[model samples]
Target chain A: MSTVTLHKVCKTFGEGKLAVHALRDIDLEVGNGDFVCLSGPSGSGKTTLLNMIGGLDRPTSGEITVANQRVDQMDKGELAEIRLRNIGFVFQAYNLIPVLSARENVEFVMQLQGIPPEIRHQKSKEILAEVGLNGMEDRKPAELSGGQQQRVAVARALVSEPALILADEPTANLDSVTAEKLVELLRHLNDEHGITFVISTHDKMVMGHARRLLKMHDGKIIDDIQQR
Target chain B: MGIVFHLAWRNLWRNRRRTWLTAGAIAFSTILLVLWVPIQFGAYEIMINASLAVFPGHAQIQRPGYQEKPKIRNAIDNAETLAKKLRASNQFVGVATRAQGFALLSSGTRSYGAQVVGVEPVFESGTSSIPGLVKKGRYLSGIDAQEMVIGAALARNLKIKIGDEVTLIGGGKDGSVAAAILPVVGIFESGSNELDRFFSEIPLHTFQNIFSMGHSAHAIAIVGKTVEEQDSLLTALRQETKDRNDIVILGWEQLVPGLKEGIQVDKVSGFIFYGILIAVVVFSILNTFLMSVLERTREFGLMLALGSRPKRIAMLMMLESTLLTLMGLIIGMTIGSALVYWVHIVGFAYPGMEDLAQQYNMPGLSRLYPQLDLFNFLIGPGSIFIATNIVAWIPVLRIRKLEPVEAMRTI
Candidate 1:
C-alpha cells in the first residue's frame, strides 16, 4: 500500500516577466488501492500535478512524499530509482517503443528491477494475458492496433507490480469502446489486485470508473467527490 | 551498460537515412586519410633514398670538415685505420671510400660546374644502388682506369658520347694544376635532375693521384644490412670512430638535411589535405547526428518517463555514434588496404613524363610509386576514428541538457 502526499506544492515556469504558474499550492493525498481520476480541460495543470506525484517532475515549492519517501528532496538519480522501484507510467499515446515486441516492452520495467530473465518472462507473459494480449506478446508495437498497443502499454505498467501506476490521459486517443474497456481494466486491477491507479483524463468513460474524482481548474483542485 | 547499447543500436536504425548519411561521412573521411598515408610517405621515402643513393650511405665516416669542403685538406689521412675499424663492426655490410671534388666540364663551347666523385667501382657499387640506375651503356668497372661514368643530364649538357674524352681540371694541394683526359665509358641516368646534371664517377686512384692526396679519400660510405638497421649501423660507426680526432660519423638523414627537410614539409602538406577532408566530412556527420537526436527527442523523453535516466540516454547516443564511426572506419580501411596492395605490386608509371623526370635527374622512374608503410596506414585510420569520436560529441552535449518532460513532448 502506498500514499502520495503533496503539501502546498507549487510549480512555476521561467522567471520574472515570463513567470507562469503551472501548479499552485496543491495539497492532496492519494491512498493505497484508490482509483483516483484527475479530470480537467487542456492547460488545467492536471498532468503537471500527476507528474509531480509520480516523481516525473518536481514542485518549485513545498514538499511531496510518496510511499514514505520524500520525493521533493530526492535528486534525479534517486528519483529515477524510486520510479524504477515503485512507480509505473502510461501515456496518452501509449508510449510503447515501436522497435520492441509486446513481451519485451512489458519486460522492460522488470528488467529495470533486475528481475531474472525467467521470472521476467513468466511475469510478462502473465501480465500480457491479464491485459488481453495473450498471443500478441511477440508482436512489435507498430504491428499492433491502437487498442492492442494500449493493452501492451498497460501490461508494461503493471508488470513491475509498482506501488503506484500514474497514467496521463491514458485512453485519450482510443475510441469510446476501447477507452471504456481500458478504464474497466484499470478499475478491475485496482479492485482485484489492490493496485493504486491515478489516471488523468478528459474522457467521461474513464472518470465514471473512478472510486474518487478530483476536479481541477486554473492549476487548483476546485472540487473533490467520492463516488457511491 | 548493455541495455544502453541495445537501445543505442535501435536508435541508430530508427532513422535509417540520417544514420547512413552520417556513416557515409565517416567512411569517406577515413578513406581520404588512409589514401593520404601511402602517397605522402611514399614520396618522402623515394626522395630520401634517391638523395642518399647519390651522396650519403646509411652512415658516413668523413674527415671532420670534409662534407663542408671536399678539398684535399679535409681528406681522411688515416684511411687504412678507419677502414679497418669500420670493417670490424658487424653493423655495416660494406664501407666504400670515395674522393669528391668540383670540376668545370667543357664540351665544345658549352661549360657547367659539376661535382665529381672518384669511386672504387666494386666497393662503391656494392654500397649504393646507384649502379643499378644506369639506363644506357655499362656502369664503371674495377679495371677501368681513367674512365668516367656521367649522369644523363651531365652527358647531355657536355654533348659528350660514350667514346668521347673529357678534360677534368682542378687545383692540387701544392698549388699545381692537376688535369686529366678521361674517356666516358658509360652514360647513366639517376632520375633526379640535380644529381644527374652535376655528378660524375671516375676510378679512385686517378683522383687520389691527381689531387696528390696519396691514397686518402674524402669520406667512407657505410651501407647497413637493411633500412631499419640504419640507426644501429650509425651508432656502431660512431663508437668505432670515438678515438679518432679527425673523423666524424653521421647518419644518412643528417648527411642530406635538404631531403629530411623536404619530407617534413611534405608531411605537413599531407596533413593539410587530410585536415580539409576531415573538416568537410565531420561537419556533415555533425549535421546528421544532430538531426537524428532531434528526431529521437520524443522517444528519448518516453524512455526517460519509463525510468531511463538522462545519463542512460546520453550513453545510448554516444554508443550509437561510436558504433557508426567504427563501422565506417573498418569499411574504409578495407578499401584503402586493397588499393595500397594493388599499387604496391603494380607501381605507378607515367610513360611521357620520362623526359621531365630526366630533366630533374630524378633517381627513380617517371611514375610516382607509393610506399606501403603499414605503420603509416594504421596511423591514418586510427587518427580518423579518434577525430570522429571527438566530432560525435556535439550531439551528446545537447542531449545532456534534455529535461524529461520536454524531451517526451518534443514532436
Candidate 2:
C-alpha cells in the first residue's frame, strides 16, 4: 500500500503581485517501507515538495494523499494530527528544541501523542541506544557534537514509529564520515524496523544510499531510477 | 488546565530575569498606590470628623435658609420642642441649641469682630469639642449668669483672660443696636486656627439677651449616636422637620460644603493616581511580553506545526502572561499590603510643616493614618491582571497572522 502520494500539485507563495511558484505539477508516489531519495540542486523545489508530501504545507492546486488520507484538504489541526501520528521529520539543522534534553526530545512527540511517561521513556531510551548514543541521553543539543545531535534527531524521528520519515538534507551540515554513518543508521532503521524514508538532498553521498532515486531540476523531476 | 498552568509557571522561570523585573515593577507600583491612596483619603476623613466635632456635630436643624444667611431674623423659636422631638427619635446622642450673631467684642483699647455662639452650657459641653479643648480657665456652668468661653486665639487678639468683662455690641431686635457686658469664662483651643481666631461661646440666655432675641435660638445642633449613625440621624431629622416648612435639617456634608468639597478633591486625586499607576504598569508589562514573544517566534511555529492548535498556542501565551502577572501580583500585594498596614499603624508624618497645616487649618502632621475602601486593594491588583491579559493578545494576534512556512524561518 502507498504511504505517500502527490497528484498534479503546485505550491505558490505570496499573493498577486509578489507570488512565486515554488513547486509546479508534481506527481509522485511512495509505497510503505520503500526508501526514496528526492535529489536536486538549490531552488529545485526539493524541500517544498517534501513539505507538501509531509502535510506541513498545502498544495496551491491539487491533492496529496498520505497514509490513505486526503492530506491536501486537511485543516491545520488535522494536518498536525497527521504529522503527530504518521509522519516523522529529520532536518538539516537538527531542529531539536534547545530546552529539551536528548531523551526528552525523543520522548516529546510521544508525549504529545499522549503516551504514558514510562512507555515514552522506555521507547525513547531504546531508540537512543539503537542510534548509538544511549548514555548521552540526558545531554542537551548544545552539549552534544554536531553528528551526535543529528543522530539524536534521527532517533527522535524513528521513536514514534512513524510510517513515512521525511528527511530534508539530513546530512548537509556533517562531515563525510559522520554523514555516511548517519545514512547507515537511517538505512539500518529502514531495513530492520520497516520504516520508509523520503530524503530530500543535493549530496551525492546521501543519494547513493537510496534504494530508489528521483532526480529533479528547475521544479521538475528529470530522472527516476530503481536499484537492486 | 492544570498542564497549562504548570507549563506557564515553568515558562516564567525560563526567563527569570524578565519575569522578576516585570514583577518588581508591578509590585513597586502597587505599593506606591496602596500607600498614597489611604493617606489621601484619610486627610478628608480627618477634616470632616474634626470639623463636625467642634461645629456641626454631624447634623444640624435650623429655620429654612438660616444656614445660608444666618441672620438674626430667621430664629427657630420652637427650639426646645425640636430638641425634644430629636431626642425622642433616639438618633441623637445630644441635642443642643445655639444662637449666633455678628458682634463687636471690645476690651480696653482692643476690638475685633467675632461670631458669638449662644450655646446651652451644660448640654453644649457634651455636644461640642469646645469644653474638652479649653486651654485656660474653667468651662462655663449652665447656671453662671455671665459666663463665656472665648477661643484662645480670640482671647489673645483681645488680650483678655478669665474674669475680664468684654462688652459685646450688636444690632438688637427691630434693628436697634444694644450693648452687653459678658465676663470671659475660659479659653478654648480647637486645633483649627480659623475657628480659634474668630469664634466665641456664651450661655444661651446671655447671647439671647445680648442680641435682644429674648429666649429664641437660631438653630438646634444634633449629635448622632456614633459616626456611622450620622446619616440616619440626619435623615430622621429631615423627615420630622418637613412639617415645619420653615426649618431645614442638614447633614454636615451639606452644612459645610467647602470642607466636604475639599475631601472630595482628595478622593478624586487618589483615583487619578491609581489610573496613572495602572497605565505605567500596563505599558511595562506589554513591552516585556512583546519582546518575549518576538524572541520565541520560531519555537512557537515549531509547536504549532508539531500539533498544537492555533487557539491552544494563544491560550498558552495568555496562560504564561497571566501566571507571570499573578506571581507578581501575589508578591506585590504582599509587599504593598505590608506597607499599607505599616502606614496605618505608624502613619506618615510631614515634620516641621505643623505651622503650614495650622495656617491652612488642615489635619495636622500627626501620624497620618490612611484608611482605604475595600475595593482599592482588589482594583489595584485586578488592574494588573486585566492589563497583562489584554497585553498578551498583542503577541498572540501577531503569531496568528504568521504563515507556518514564514514562522518556521523567523529564527
Candidate 3:
C-alpha cells in the first residue's frame, strides 16, 4: 500500500509579473517502507516537492495525499494535524528548539501527541539509544555536534511513529563520514520499523543509499530509477 | 498541560537576564504601592487624632442649631439632665458641659475680641485637652473661684501676666447686663493660631452667671475612649435623643467635613497613581513576551509544523507569560511586605515634619506608620494579577496569527 501519492501537482510563488513556478506536473507514489531520494540541483523544485509532500506547504494546484489523507486542500490547522500525526519532517538545518534538552527535544512531538510523561520519557530514551546517542538525553542542542543534533532530530521524528518522514537535505551540513553514518541509521529505521522516507538532497551519498531515485530538473521529474 | 507548562517555563528562562529584569519592574511597582498606601493612611490617622484632641472631642451634644449659630441663646436648657444621661450611657469617657459666648476682653491698656468658653474645672481634664495645653501658670482650680485660663497669644496681645485681672463684657442670654473681672491663672498655647489668640476658658458657673444663662449650657462635648468609637457613640446618642427636638448630636466626620473631603481626594489620587504604576509594569511584561515571540519565530513555526495547533502555540506563549507574572507578583509582594512591616515597626519620619506637625493641634513630631493587611494585599497585588493576565493576550494574539511557513522562514 502506498504511504503517499501525488498527481498533477504544481506550485507557484508570487503573482502577475513576478511569478515563479516552483513545481510542475509532479506525479509520484511511495509505498510503505520505500526509501526515496528526490535529487536535483538548487531551485530544481526538490525541496518544494518535499515540503508539499510533508504538508508543510500546500500546492497551488494538485491532489496530494499522505497516509490516506488529502493534504493539498487542507487548511493550515488541518495540515498541522496531518504533519503531527501522520508525517514527520527533518529539515536541512536540524532546527532543534535550543532551550530543550536532548530528551525533551526527542519527546517534543510525543508530548504534543498527548502521551503521558512516564511513557514518553521511556519511549524517547529508547529512540535516542537506537539513534546511537544513549546517555546524552540531558544535553542541549548547543552541546551536541552537527551529527549528534541531526540524530536527535531523527529521534524526535521516529519517536512519534509517523507513517512517513520527509527530510529536506538531512545531511547537507554534515561531513562525509557523518553523512554516511546518518544514511545508515535512516536505512536501519526503514528496514527495522517499516517507516517510509522521502528525502530531497543534492548529496550523491544520499542518492547512493536511496532504494529508489528520482531526478528532477526545472520543476519536473525527468528520471526515475530503482536503486536496489 | 504539563508539557505546555514545561515549555512555557523553560522558554522564559531562555533569556534569563531579560526575564528577571521584566519581573523586577513589576515587583518594583507592587512595592511602591506597599510603601505608598501605608504612609498615606498613617499620616491621615495621626493628623485626625491630634486635631480631635484640641477639643470639641469626637462627638458633641448641643441645643438645636447651636452648631449653625453659636450664641448663649442657643444653650441647652436641659444640659444637666442630658449630661447625666450621657454619663450613665457609659459609651463615653466623660461629657463636659460648657456655655461659650463671643465677648471682648480688656486689660486697662489693651482690649481684644475673644471667644470666652465656660467650663467646669474638675471635669475638664477628662473631657477636653485645653487643661493640658497650659504653657504657663496653672489650670483653673475651682468653678466658684474667680480665675481663668487664657491663651498665650491672647496674653501677649493684652500684655497681661498671670494674676493680672481681665474684664470680659458681653450680652446676657436674657438681654441683661453680663460682665466679669477674673484673674488669669494660666496661659496655654494650643498650637492652633486662632485658638491661641482668641480663646479664653473660665468656670461654666461663672460664665453662666456673667452671661445670665441660668443653669443652661451651650454644648456638651463628649469624649470617647478612641476616635473610632465615635460612630457607635453617635448612633447611641441619636437613639437616646430621638424624642428630644431641642438638641442635635454630631460625629467627628459630620463636624469636620474638610478632613473627610481631604481623605477622599487622596484616595482618588492614590487609585490613579496605582493604576498607572501597575499598567506600566504589565506593559513591560507584554513587551518582554512579545519580543520573545518575535525572536522565537522559527522555533514556533517548527513546533506548528510538528503538529502543534496555532492556538496551542499561542496558549504556550500565554502560559509562559502567566508564569512570568506569577513570579513577579510573588517576589514583589514578598519584598514589599518585608519593607512595609519594617516601616510599621520602626516608624518613618521626615526632617522638618516636626515643625510642620507642631503647627497643627497634634502634640508631637510627625512619624507615620502605615498599616498593612489583607486589604492592601488584595488591592495592590490582585490588581497586578488581573492586569498581567489581560496584557499577556497581546503577545499571544500576535503569535496566533503567525503563519507556520512564514515563521519557519523568519531566521
* Candidate with best DockQ: 3
TM of chain B vs. native, candidate 1:
0.85
lDDT of 1 by residue, A1-228 (tens): 447889999999899999989899999999988999999889999999988987888899989989899999998888888888888888888888777789988887777778888898899999999999989889989999898998898888888778899999988899889889888889888888888999999988888999899999889999999984
Q: Write the per-residue lDDT of candidate 2 for residues B198-277, one digit (tens) a residue.
A: 89888877777767787578878887765546767867787777778777788887788898787677677777878888
For B26-144, candidate 1 gives per-residue lDDT tens digits of 77777766766886677666666556655477778887766676566678875745776777765578778877877777767777788778777877765666676677777787623
Q: Could you give candidate 3's per-residue lDDT for residues B33-55 as a string of tens digits?
A: 77777777777777677776777
Worst 10 residues of 3 chain B by lDDT: B356-365
Model 3 CA deviation exceeding 4 Å by range:
B63-77, B106-112, B144-146, B165-179, B235-246, B352-366
Task: Give the residue spans of candidate 2 off by over 4 A.
Answer: A12-20, A74-77, A102-139, A144-148, A151-163, A175-181, A191-195, B1-7, B62-95, B103-114, B125-127, B132-139, B150-179, B186-197, B209-249, B353-365
Best by lDDT: 3
What TM value does the first chain of each candidate achieve?
0.98, 0.97, 0.98
Residue B383, candidate 3: C-alpha displacement in angstroms: 3.0
DockQ for the candidate 2 complex? 0.42
Interface RMSD of 1: 1.7
Clashes per prediction?
Answer: 10, 1, 1
lDDT of 3 by residue, A1-228 (tens): 999999999999999889999999999999999999999889999988988898878899989989999998788778888888898888889999988888998888998888999999999999999999999999999999999999999999998899999898999999999999999999999999999999999999889999999999999999999999
